[model samples]
Target chain A: MKKKILVIGAGSDVAQALSRLRAERGHILWLTARSQEALQPLLADLKVRYQVEALGFVYDAELHSAEDLMAQLPGIPDEVHVAMGYLGNPDRLDDPKDAARILKVNFSAAVLLMNAVMHAMIEKQVKGVLVGISSVAGERGRKSNFLYGAAKAGFSTYLDGLRNAGFSHGIHVMTVKPGFIRSKMTAGLPLPGPLTASPQQVASAIIKGMKKGRGTVYVLPVWSLIMLLIRNIPDVVFKRLNL
Target chain B: MGTPMSALTKISNWGNYPRIEADVRPWPLQTESPQIARGMGRCYGDSALSTHIVDTRSLNHFLDFDAESGLLTVEAGLTFDEILQVCVPRGWFLPVTPGTRFVTAGGALASDVHGKNHHAEGSFSDHVRWFDLLTASGEICRCSRTENTELFYLTLGGMGLTGIIKALAFYLKPIETAYIRQHTLRCENLDETMAGLEAYGHWTNSVAWLDCMAGGRAFGRSILMLGESAKQSELTQAQSLNPLKVHSTKGIPFPIDMPSFTLNRFTVQAFNQVYFHKHPKGSRDSVVHYEPFYYPLDKVLGWNRIYGKRGFTQYQLVIPHADARKGLQEVLELLAKRKMSSFLTVLKIFGEQSENYLRFPKAGFTLTLDFGISASLWPFLNELDGVVERYGGRLYLTKDVRMNPDFFRRTYPMAQEFMEKIKALDPTGKFQSLQSQRLGIHA
Candidate 1:
């Protein structure tokens, strides 16, 4: 059956891959990004390559209210993928503004958007799937990126609560914990090659998870075990060793 | 969404030679002079290498397409692999494609890459309608045959020295199916191979795999493969049902670099002998998927690792038709005498050259040989360059890493003109590459 899919942060690498995959499956796409200029090309590409309707909406998480953003959509979509994220320089935490921006973009704004989308789905009686892309860094805090991790940890928890609340309402919520994605957010980092997943891998995994109604997904299954080990490490030993 | 952070990273081209540290950033950053745009880093040598690299992979996006006319517009960073996935199912195919589908549209244009069908379709630039180039002055200039005519021709094989190619419009050949009707001819020697290629000139695509290690009478023994895009009517029942199915083979990755000693002369000779005898005698015809027909090597991801950590260089040269036989013979004989082994050797015939200033192909025969890097390889290649120059041949800049300025000037002839034009366009010597600097092509 054909479906309507909404992808927030459409200019992101993972969002682009996910949108392309969904478009290939003959789904109608509503993509939102901060810059319509960046989203226009992707929208045009999807329409041409898949011969599907693809519309674009300019959305900035910091500036736009959740209700206003949701109201701009044509109607309730069959699926909503929240892929927005911010990984500001951890070293710049000395500046409170940077720290606050990271937390708001990753956690607060995501929660508000997902909440609005969930209510819209329920009010319209649409048994749709909602996917939130969190990170493995949320599994446990690390010295290198704890601020970003704390925000993602909050987002992951929020999705867990949403999954419980929406189950009765026939809404499926999924949280994706992707480890070391080779994307713009992690571009400069020296990510472990074997552990890192390409945006396509993450996108495919998310699609599979949505179909299975899995509450949480690790893009690479190994990431589950890796996160387990990191989460279990003794506090003293982990603090002594630099990651 | 936001701009990806730039990083100082260690990078190398497909050949993995002359590895260098470069400031690599996503595309469309503020204009920076002396920066080179790199896509997939598929070019075999220093042509794509520079201190600062504008990574164009993120710019991959389809801008427009006309299903009826087969006119397609796409961002420069779009790869042929991505194009085939979308277009093939719609019965459209690239007008001209290099051996590997991993090449980017921009890279293909800058290199003016030729394919087995060059004798029939010319080079990549011939099918291009126009392109938007981000000039050194940060202005987006639309270049085509009529508009920005001089810049258009100069940029086409300009080695990305003219500016960064942002987007392009080109025509795709409409095909009935995704399969190719292939015919293979086994030739016993150089003369037979040349005759076979000439005999099969009517085919849309023709190329030969040479046994470069063969000596004496067996020299240049090859298998000539000819192909014509298979029509729906030509496919078997099973294929005709899904005649437009695109290639979906996820190639196996080459996990680790083979030890340097694994690619020695003895091993290469044995592999060549086995490969030569694997095919039956005389001519054989079969319908094959375009994947295997056009890109057999792409099946082994990072196959260049076979050359080991020291890396290798591909020496590709073309000699005018009149001197092709002699030039090829001399080059092969020299390699044999030197006891140098090239694991992969290819030969093709090219048709009329384009007016594009620096495009590599001309009315000629071209040969490509890959040699692993070694201390003696440089001097040996220099000697081979002399033989090529004597035969009025020129080396492919896309595959070259160490051709001296004098040799480059003598062979390309239009190097000075290209430099002068680029100078007028980029007066501050912006958009220079290691190759341009090495060959004195910059202002």
Candidate 2:
């Protein structure tokens, strides 16, 4: 059976990978972004390449309520990929508007959409899967970008709780904690090979993970091991270390 | 009636994994509460981890006994010590005993645990005459091969997923004494070791302790050990002296976690080499204590701390009888490459088809190894899971800590069948555990 997948925040690189992978699966896809024009070329290329149903829509995730936006969807897609994120600068968050914008965009927006999707899922009474892109930064706070880290942390915790709720209901919620992905999100930063992943790698992982129904995964796979070591760092010495 | 307190459920072997947090309520103590059955806390993992534990340890009450018929009835929580305490003195023994005696009558049937003698005796399920189960709706169910056969099969190796076993009626074997006439052979490699095992194919009880430390030329080197109760004619003056007077001090408990690096290649290699050479290679008549003979590791309490706070996981998988040889070779090779040394590695030959399709041991070769949690262990286990799947084998859920849901479903094709039965009995999915929730078993 063919699947119809909807990708939110389709202008981002991770969104590009999500759209491309779903297109390859020959799925019916609806890619959404702030401006339909920004997503048009990719949607056209996807339709031409995979020959599946493809379309683009302009939707601002931060401004719209999930129920209102969900009603606008052509139909409930086979799967929903939420890739919206805001890796805003933590050091320059003096402005109340900037801080709240980041919080609403990264945390509030995704939760709203998830809540609506979950209700739709329960009503439909069908087994479904959801994947959210979280960051290793969310695992624990570091000095580098904790504002972004804290937001991912909150989002990841929310997803965890959601997964617990959906588990018995046959709906799977996965939280993908990518350690360091070389996307627009981390273009200039130096990343170790084993600890880092590419957008394509992350996309492949998500696709494989969803098919496997794995509820949680570390994109690089090695991060679980690295994180194990990090978790054991004694508080006495951990507080003194300079990262 | 309202849902039973979340605290009142009992869980079994397949239920503990990923280490999640939850409230486990004890079984109700009221007169109306259903009678409980306690199993050996070691159904490998969670098979016995539940609320309302029968504490079979106290139920050690013995009922009717027919010495000539080898049929006996005992409470569900009785320990092997208590059983052996009473029965062995009367020249009678359990028909089937798994590796560990720490198990109870309820657990043995719940897991349908097999032993070195599996090829001959099948499993504990095959020995059970009948049992009493406390169903979810608060009913006492008497099930057996002739009665509620479906429930009977479901409870056997059913992981206690069916209902709580309250008591068991099983047949016992007549033995002369507690001593076992034993033999041991040292095999050079995996092939030689399996060859030694197959040579003793008809022995009453047989198992092999492998030296996983040996790699390449000598990997899977092991001591092929076989034994059975000594005949009256074979007992010497000293051996027949006193059967019930066995004595040994309990093992000292570990006070603190060992350093993670304490078990590096050098340390483990030395231990394995020393242990391998210490056991003499000859047929000898020696009176051995049951604890050392069977539960040797049980001597060291709190052994998990040996891996430090990061406990180790035992990855036990069995390749089908057809691909047993080649598959085990590749698996051991992978473990060597990963340098994941276990405290103890074991190899056993199982019997023909088991009653429980999803059960771990089958008509094949089973290998178990303890692995300390490492940064590289997940990917390594994932790779091993793939290999096991390709060979039409599955990881034992009791010991699994890393296998994902997809891998689990593929390996156990009969899973849907098992799940169907469970849902009918537990439509609301009231009883749950970390492993069941993680692997989607409850659904």
lDDT of 2 at A127: 69
Candidate 2 lDDT tens digits, B170-246: 99888777777777778878998898878888888788989988977788888888877777666667766865333
List candidate 1 stretches off by more than 4 Å: A93-97, A139-146, A221-243, B1-7, B30-33
Q: Rate the local accuracy (lDDT) of all candidates.
A: 0.90, 0.71
lDDT of 2 at A57: 73
lDDT of 1 by residue, B1-443 (tens): 12245567999999999899988777766346478999989999899988888889998899999988899999999999999998999999999999999999999999998899999999999999999999887899999999999999999988999899999999999999999999998999999998888888999999999999988888999989999999888899999889998887599999999898888889999999999999889999999999999989899899999889999999999999898999999999999899899999999999998888886888889999999999999999999999999999998989999999999888887887887888888888778788888988863
i-RMSD of all predictions:
4.7, 29.0
The number of the candidate with the highest DockQ is 1
How many backbone overlaps does candidate 1 show?
A: 0
Best candidate according to lDDT: 1
The true-versus-predicted C-alpha distance at residue A114 of model 2, in Å, is 69
- For candidate 2, the lDDT comes to 0.71
